[model samples]
Each structure stands twice: as structure tokens, then as C-alpha cells.
Target: MQMMEYYFGLISVVAQSSENVLFLVKPILPIMLRIIAPVLGVVVIAAFAGNVMQVGLRFSTKPIQPDFSKINPNPVRFITKMLFSRQSVMNLGKSVFKIATISVVAFFLVKKDLFWIMKTMDMGVLQAFQLCLLLAFKLIMVVSGLLLILAIPDYFFQRREHTESLKMTRQELKEERKLLEGDPLLRARMRERQKSYAKRRMIQEVPKADVVITNPVHFAVALKYEPLRMGAPECVAKGQDLIAQRIKKIAEENDVSVVENKPLARELYKRVDIGDEVPEDLFTAVAEIIAFVYKLKQKEAVNV
Candidate 1:
């Protein structure tokens, strides 16, 4: 059983390898390195191409490498799986095809019975070995071709298995959607809570603001300037949507007057970040608003 297994394993490897090597056959000849370089180069290229087809060019630690013994062993379970499992069906079918091809081919060579093969002349051992080597290489190519045919179906099955394994289920889709967008009711509650939180933070910082900009009904921003941190106006608080309404309400409560300008409000929201300066392009419009707000504070102070 062990001898049978060892021989089977050897044949299986030869059959598989032959497929890849057959691709190197050139009616075409390159003048230089001939068989050696071209064969190695093609093997590397084909392996690379095959790998890319499987994973679309990414790197990871996953592979379908099976335990060495399970591939072909004297053991009954290994043999059973190889012959009875679906994988067995595929493998056996491939093997039978490859074996028939190799048998037919080897028979031709055997009948040619070129006594030259057995003729180990008094010629140097090196000369004799050179003859054997050529014959062996020829044999290898024939086997490789057979293996490649088998590998075609094997590659198809492997790809199908890989894709099926990685395909997402409906439940996975739903879970991913939930993660991206929280439940609508939950989202609504979060927005309200965030609005209230913003209002409190805005009011606490309102009196210290250099200016407050608004769309009157919908948007609001508060900017602060400090000489030491002194280069530009910084948004101390900014808000939109329902939160924009809340910010306007908070500004009113804190005696921070609001100015309504649709363009200015939209521009600030798009270009400025909280605690960051309004861009230079908006300087004229923003400065004009800041001056107006400052005048309002002075007028209120005078009235008081």
C-alpha cells in the first residue's frame, strides 16, 4: 500500500507539473538560453497570472494548501476522500484522462525501442547521461501537457469554490447597512441630543465670540479671534439642519445677534472647520458681518 501510494503521489505531481510546463513549448526558438530560461520564465509568469486571476492582485495569508499526507496516503480515509468525495470525483476523472494520454504516448516511445536508449556505450558516463537527460526532458514535456489539460478543470473548480466561499449572505448585507446608518429612530434621537449638546456648548462660548454669522432662519456660526493664537478667525461653534435652528435660538438667548445671509452661511459651512479660520476668499464678506455684530453689542451696551 505504501509503495502504491508513493508511486501514485509521484505520478500525480508529474501530471500536475506537466500542465504548466507544456505552455513553454516553442515551435519558436529564441537563439540564446533556449529551453532553460524560457521554461523558468513561463512558469513564473503563468503562476503569477493564475494567482492574480484568483484574488485580483492582493496579498493575504490564505491558501488552499492541504496537509501533505491527505493529498495521497496509504491510509483508507485519504484514499476514500480522493476517490469518493466530490473532490475525489474531479481528481479521479482528471487522473484517468491524464493516464490514458501518457500511456498512449509512452507506448509510442517504447515501441520506437530505439536501442540507442539502452546503448550505454563505452562513451563517457557524461555522454550517456546527456542522452538520458534529453529523453527525460522530452518525457517531462509530454507529461506536462497532459497535466495542463487536467489542470484546466481543476482551476475551474478551485475558482468556483473560492468565489462561493467568499460571497456575502443577505444577513451580512443587512448588518453592514445597519453599521453605516443607525436605525432611523435612533438617528433622530442622536441628532436631537447632539443639537442640545451643541446649544449648551455654543452659549457657554457666545460672549467670547468675535462674530456670529447666520442665514437668519436656518444656519449659524460663531467665530473667535485671539491675538496670541492671533492669525485668523476660528469657528467656535457652527451648526446646520435642526441644529442650525437650535444654534440661532441659543445666540438669541445669549444676546448674540444673528445676521441672515444665505451665501455666507453656506460658504462657511462648506469651507471652514470648527476652530479653523474662514478662507481668504470669504474675508470681505465675513469681516463686514463681524463689524455689524460688534456694532450691535456696542449699541446694546449704550442703551443699557
Candidate 2:
């Protein structure tokens, strides 16, 4: 319709003037630009808006990235496969159906309008032209609307197909999981090594302790205190069951005082970590223990 308008305008301008070709060209250029510019602008804006509505403002270079491995030098094989593929056949069928449906609809619309126009033979040329323009505009809108409706199903199908194509196989999924969380066997070994190192360090600290407080058999906590170096007695090592036995053995070997205080031992093991001072609530209990251990050491030193 816009093209027809441009052509009609050009003809009207030329018909009014017996001017030279150069003079005609000047008027024709401006009229052509005026008729074409708005239509072109509307088309460009509509295309951009439709794309934005479908997939909003995303920037990705993956689509444009070169993958030379996918390129086939032999065009014949590629073309044959492309044309005969199931997807290709389906697309061809859909295209043919759309074209046929739209053609049938457009033919009936034009035929009906033409019949009406012919019946009113006394209508002026300008009025007939206006009616024809209105019919053309309606035809364009109806066709576009039908195509847009058809495109919705195609969009969903394409999205599902793309997602399915990108799905990983079982082996691929396993490999990806390993990459994310590390190999199971290797992680188990790492945890075992960490536990062993911590146990060794705890055993080494037991011999340097001033006193080993015990839950008699269930729990053991070894503490060390130095007035000049530490503010309060700090648990140097703590353990339960077999580990408690090991701590007690090391303390005995080093001649460290072993005290049976089930409540204090359990409380210190639960509340104080290795290298941390006993809590303020246990200050009086720990102070008396430390003072007794110091007195015992002083008596032993005097006898030696």
C-alpha cells in the first residue's frame, strides 16, 4: 500500500509538470523518501520490539563463535541431508500449509470486496480507491495476525528441541558432578588425612600438659597453664573412649598429673576446644586444680 502511494504521488507530480527530467527527479526524490521513510521506520521498530518481547536484552557471542569442526567442505552431502531431514520435511509442510491458507483467505477477501465495489458502479474513483486501500490494510493486518499466532507453537517447539539437544548423557552428567563436587574417593582420602593429622597433633600436645582431667573412662581433657604466657588454663588436648586412654597414657609417660573429675572433664571437652581457655563459669574450679598441680610440682622439685 505504501509502495502504491509512492508510485501514485510520483505520477501525479510528473503529470502536472512538463519540466525537464532533471527537474522531475528533484521533486520525485523527496516524495519517494517522504512516502517510504515512515513505513520503513515502522517496520524496523516492529521487528526490534517483537524480538525484545520474545527474548529480552541478552548479549551472547556463542551463536557467532566459529566452530571449524562443524564445517563440511563437500556441499553435496550437506545439502542432501539438510533437504531430506525429518525436521526439514516438517518445516516444508508447515510452510506450504501457511502459504495455502493465507492465499485462500486473501483471495476470498479480495473477491468479496471486489464484488461489492462492482455492484456500486456509481461510486467515485477516489471513494473506490479509499475503499480498496482500507481492504488492503485489513488484509495485511489479518495475514500478519494469523502468522503471529502460528509462530507461537513454532517458538515453543524450537525451544524444547534446543533444550533436548543440549541435554547431557548419564556419563556426561557424572563427569559434570565430579567437576562440581570433586571425586568421591579422593575426598574420602582427604578427610581421613585431616583426621589423622589432628589426632597426631593432639597426642603430641598431651605430654606437655600440666594436668589430665578425666571422666574416669569416657572422656579426657588435658590442660596447660603458664601465668606469664597464658591468662587462664587452656585445654591442650581432648578426646573420648580409646582417644581418652591414649591421652591418659601419654600424660602418665610424661609424669603429668591425672585428676578424676568427671563433670569438669565432660564440661571442658564439650565447651572448650583445643588451644582455648576454659570458660569463665569454670574459672574457680580450674584455678583450684592449677594451684594444686603447681603445689605438687613444687613438692616434687624440693625432694629432687
Candidate 3:
């Protein structure tokens, strides 16, 4: 009412002189800012708080990223789902119930005060306005209380729906764990594949060996030496158990000399790797074996 009176006064002033328009508008701007400032401040704070509650203090552009999933390819099915789904039906029913209940409450409230409302016409305009305001306040309080009562069941229903939506399938759970901790099965398969390739490469190198030293049953270490290229004998292949058997078979198939030297084979298999030179501590023993093999090859050459 005061605002309406002020606007009416401003109109009267504008009618008298166009020059006075700026004077009236200047004061109104400050008053408008005073009214809007606190409301704007509250809105900004609430929005900030809501974001913090939902995702902590993190900042990301992902929320604004275009989501193609929201675009329905089957419009007919989308419309049917929107209108006929259980959730839609429940929401429609709740809206109808709320409107009907509020209408009934409002009707009865007015009916109870029907006499007092009728007497407002006989009272002064100011008194009638005050009575109307009081009645409107009462209606608002009652309606708010009714809505609060209705919200209790709604809160639990929404909570249960949210919980259901969050549930994951076994595959989804596995994928999520894989993303967080890495896929253990995939990692193991890769390791096994790497070992297989390594073993294949080692077996290939065995055919190039000058001599194979073996524990006779459990261990094998194949050595190679190129006098002009290599400074010392290098283990071309080394293995134990089944792999040892495989190395010995490969060496024998390639006609590489196999010397039964249990202690030398065990030490080489334990301490050396393919492509590594024999250690300084085992140099004397390895040199003796190499000399014997070379002498045997020379005798075979002379006989041929």
C-alpha cells in the first residue's frame, strides 16, 4: 500500500513537471538497492553452500559439459515413460492430494471466519486490511505446518529411491574397482605373457651357446664365447627344473657340448643371467671347461 501511494505520488509529480522525474528516480534507486542487496547476498551464499555440501570445495567444468544421454532417441517411449511410470503416477497423485487438501483446509478456515470476514465490510478500510492480513498469516502458518507433515514421508521415499539408484551391478562394481585399484587379472596375464616371451628368447639363445653345463637333472646353464668379440664367456641361457630340462634338450638338439658339472651349473643358474659374463670368482673353472671343449673340437676336426 505504501509503495502504491509512493508510485501514485511520483505519477502526480511527473504530471506536474518532466524535469522532476530524475529527482524522484534518484532516491528510489538507493531504496531499491537497499532492498535487493541482502536478498542477493543470501542467494549467493546459499548457492555456494549448496555446491560445497554436494561436492565439497572442488571446481570442475564437467557439470557444464554437454550430456548426450539426456537426448532421447525414441521420443514416443520417452513420453510414455514420463507419463505412465510409477514415479510419475506417484508424483501426480501427491500433487492432486496436496492441492485438494490445501483447498479443503482453506475452505474450512474461511468458513469458520465467515462471520468475522463479513463484518470487515462494516469496519473501516484500515481495520479491514489488518484483519485480512492476520487471516492470510494464519492460513499461511497452517498450510506450512500441513506441508511439513506431508514432507516427512516424502523425505524417506526420496531417500529410498536415491539409495536404489546408487546400487551397482557386479560388472559395474568390478569396473569401478578396476578403475580405482587396477585390474589384477589383466596384470597377471600380462606378466605371464612377458615371462613366456622371455623364456622363448632364452631358448632361442641356447642354440647359439658354445657349451651347456648341467646339474644333470635339475639345473642348466648354457655359455657362449666369441674370442674376437667377447672378452669373457657369457651365459646365453640358464634355467631350473622343467626349464632346465627344456634348455638341455634344446642344447643337445643343436649339438652343443653338454658337460655334467653340478656345482658349476647350480652356481651359474643361481648367480648369472642370460647375456651376463661369468663372474671373476668362477673365471678359472669356466676357462678350464672352455679349453677342454676347444681341445675336443680340434681332435674331431683333425679326425675328420
Candidate 4:
């Protein structure tokens, strides 16, 4: 429709000019380039914008990969199956619907304009030409708007269908996991070895603790302090449940003081980590506990 309007305008310009056909022929190449440039520019921009909006920026050579199987000459098994596919059927239906709708719209518009033109028979040639152009523009706008509305749903459906088609089976998922994470047994053994080393290091630190605060059974937090070497008590080891039992047992063997302070033990276990200082809010309570433990140790030393 746009090309038709452009051709009409070009003809009108040429008709009004005093130049002969031979003279116009000399500059036809430049005129043709001017007309083709905008059309090509619009097509290129539309193609790029449509792809970007649908899938963003993606680089894939899969579509262009050579596949000899696709060149099968069997029409019933290959070509016919593709022709009768769901997507092909849907596209055919959409094309037919668009053609029917546009035809109906153009028929009514032309009918209305024809009646107006007939009623005003004395209208000038230029006026009649302008009226036809106006009608053509309106018809094009209506058809383009309808097609654009239809295209939005089709684009989303195609994207969703494509995604579902790419879903992996259980076997494929297992293969991908093996490729990415290596052998399961080997990974598990490595994890266990790491935990064993960490637990041994934690047990070694427990002997250096000045006091082991306990939630009595569930939680344990070991704190160490030195007047000359440290400013405040720092947690040396902390654990719960089985690890807590192990920490208390190791402290007992080392003759470290284990004080039962449920509230302080639970708070330190939750808030403080190994090698971290106790929070300022718990400074006074922790200081009193440390002082009591120190006094007990001094008295035991004097008795010995």
C-alpha cells in the first residue's frame, strides 16, 4: 500500500514537470536509490527490533547446522507431515482470517467513498485523487493495527512452545549433573574428609578455652581470655547436639571448667561464632562468669 502511494506521488511529480521522458531516464538510478533506501532501512530496523523484543541478544548456530536427514525426498513421511503440522495449520488459519477481515474492511471503505464521489460528480480530478489517497491510508492503518494485535499472542505462544520443547528428560538431567559435578561418591568422600579435619581442629582449640559455657545438654560455647594478650573473651569453639556433647567431653578430659549457663550459652551459640568476641550487651555477664572461673582455679592451685 505504501509502495502504491509512493508510485502515485512519483507519477504526479513527473506529470507536473516540463522534462521529457528521455531526460528523466538519465537520473532514474538516483531516483530509484532514493525510493529504495527508506524502504530497506525500515525493513532492517523492524527485523532487528522484533528479534530483540522476542529473545533479547542471543548467538546460536544450531538453526544453520547442516543436517542431511532434513533433505528426505519422501513426501508422505516428511513434507506432508510438516505441511499438516499444528503450527502450519494455525498459520494457514491466521492468514485466511486476516485476508477475509481486510477484504471486508476495504469493501465497506470503498463502497462509502464511491457513494460520496457519485454524489459529488462535479468534484475536480485533484480532489478525487486526494479522496482516494485518504481512503487508502485509512484502510492500510486498519489492516496493520489488526495484524499487530494478532501477532502479539502468536509471538508469546511460539516462545512458550519452544521452551517446553527444550525440556530435558530424567536421563539427560542425570548426564548433565555427572558432567557438571563429577562422581557422587567421590564428592561425598571429599566433604566427609573436610568435616573430619574441621572437627579435629575444633577439638584441639577446646583445651585452650578458659571456660566452657553449656545450655546444660543441647548447646556449648567455649570462651578464652587473656589479660595481657586479649581485650575481651573470644569464643574458641561452639556446637550443638552431638558436636556439643563432643566439645564438653573433650573439655572434661583436658580439665577445662564447664559452667552451666543456659541463657548465656544459647545466646553466645546463636550470636557469636568461633574466634569472635561476645557482643557488648553480654559483656558484664560474661566478665562475671570469667572472674568466678578464674577465682576457682586460683583457689584449686593454692590447695595443690
* Backbone clash count for every predicted candidate, in the order shown: 3, 0, 0, 0
When sorted by TM-score, best at the front, the candidate numbers are 2, 4, 3, 1
Span of 10 residues, lowest total lDDT, candidate 1: 23-32
Over 1-304, each residue of candidate 2 has an lDDT whose tens digit, in order, gives: 5544555556666755556556657766887799789989998998888777665777899889999988999899899889988778878998998999899989888887887668546764456667876887899998989888988887787777768778998999999999999999999999999999999998999988999999979999999998899999989999999999999998999999999998999899899999999899997998899889999999999999
Clash pairs of candidate 4?
none
| Residue range 1-304, candidate 1, lDDT tens digits | 3433444345546645566445333322452256579788988998899788766888755566655653554578766765698766866777787788788888787556467676857644556666777877787787788777767877888889778768888988878877899777898999999978866776677656766688766677887767597576788888777867777776677766677888898889878977688788887787787778778879989999
TM-score for each model: 0.43, 0.56, 0.47, 0.48
RMSD in Å for all candidates: 16.9, 9.4, 10.4, 11.8
Q: Show the colliding residue pairs in model 1.
A: 18-144, 19-144, 19-148
- Estimate the TM-score for candidate 2: 0.56
Where is the poorest 10-residue window by lDDT in model 4? 1-10
lDDT string for model 4 (1-304, tens) is: 4444555456667765456555555556677788789978987998899888888989889889998878878878786778888878977887898789878877887787788667446765556667766777788787778778877987898799779779998999998998899879889999999988987888899999999999979999999998898878999999999999999999999999999999999999999988889899998999999999999999999999
**After superposition, candidate 1 runs with Cα above 4 Å error:** 1-86, 98-207
Report the lDDT tens digits of candidate 3 across residue range 1-304.
4753566456765755556777667767887798879978986996688556544698789989999998899999999999999889989999999999999999999999999899998985556777887999899889978987886687677768768778998999999999997889988899999999998999999999999999999999999999899888999898889999999999889888899999999999899888899999998899899889999989999999
Relative to the true structure, how large is the alpha-carbon lDDT of every model?
0.73, 0.86, 0.87, 0.85
Report the candidate with higher lDDT, 3 versus 4.
Answer: 3
